[model samples]
Structures are given as C-alpha cells and as structure tokens.
Target: MTEAPHNDPAEQTLRELESRVEALVQFCDRLQEENRLLRQENEQLRSERAVLSERGEQARIKVESMISRLRSMEQAS
Candidate 1:
C-alpha cells in the first residue's frame, strides 16, 4: 500500500474538526439543561395561569351581577 503525503493543512484540518466536535457536545449539554429549566418554568406558569383564569372568571361574573342589580334598582326608581 502506498503511504499518503504528510500535509500540514490536513493535520490542521483534523485538529479543527476535533475541536468542533468537542464544542458541539458541550453545546448540546447546555441546551439540554436549558430545555429542562424551561419546561419546569412552563409548568409553573401554566398552574399560575389556571388560577388566575379562575379568579378572573369569578370577578367577571360578580361584576355582571352587580351591573344587573343596579339596572333593576334604577328602573324601579
């Protein structure tokens, strides 16, 4: 088998490729952690939103009832 030429450019390219792979692995790990945190935050926000929605509905009903009652009183006057 013939031996390939020892090119400096090829060696540099190999080094650059190895570094890129290492960086990619690190980036994947960081993204995974960030995704986990975001999921937890989303769950918390959903719970809070549900509670707020219920409270808003209750407030809306109360206001509607009050408006209805005021209209009847004014009509009676």
Candidate 2:
C-alpha cells in the first residue's frame, strides 16, 4: 500500500499565505463595488440639488413680482 506524502512545515506555511492572499483579493473587490455604488448615489444627489435650486429661484422671482404689483396698486390708491 502507498502512503500519502506528509506535509512539511514550509509547505504548510506557504499554503496559509496563499489563502490569506486570496481573502485579501476578495476584500478588495468588495470595496471597489461599494465605492462605485457610492459615486453613483453622490451624482444623483447632486442632480437633485440642482433641480431644487432652480425651482427655488423660480419661486423667488414670482413672489417678488407679486410684491411689486401690490406696492404699485397701494401707491395709486
């Protein structure tokens, strides 16, 4: 009967190191995906902010126009 080869200390250490490296690679991949999603969310929020700012400006212009009309009417009366 043939016996299986026994693991030497050096070979065992090498195997452990290889496993750690693979785990690090997976962790890096997960971080990259998370970063990509965050960038997309940030861009969407910026677009929404711009739209809201434009709407606020339009509302301010309308209010100013109404106030001017009221002042003119009061002066005439």
Model 1 residue pairs with clashes: none
C-alpha RMSD of candidate 2: 2.9
**Which stretches in model 1 have alpha-carbon errors above 4 Å?**
1-18
lDDT of each: 0.96, 0.95
Q: Write the per-residue lDDT of candidate 2 for residues 11-56, one digit (tens) a residue.
A: 7888899999999999999999999999999999999999999999
The 10 consecutive residues of candidate 2 with the worst lDDT sum are 2-11
**Clash-forming residue pairs, model 2:** none
Q: What is the TM-score of each candidate against the true structure?
A: 0.67, 0.86
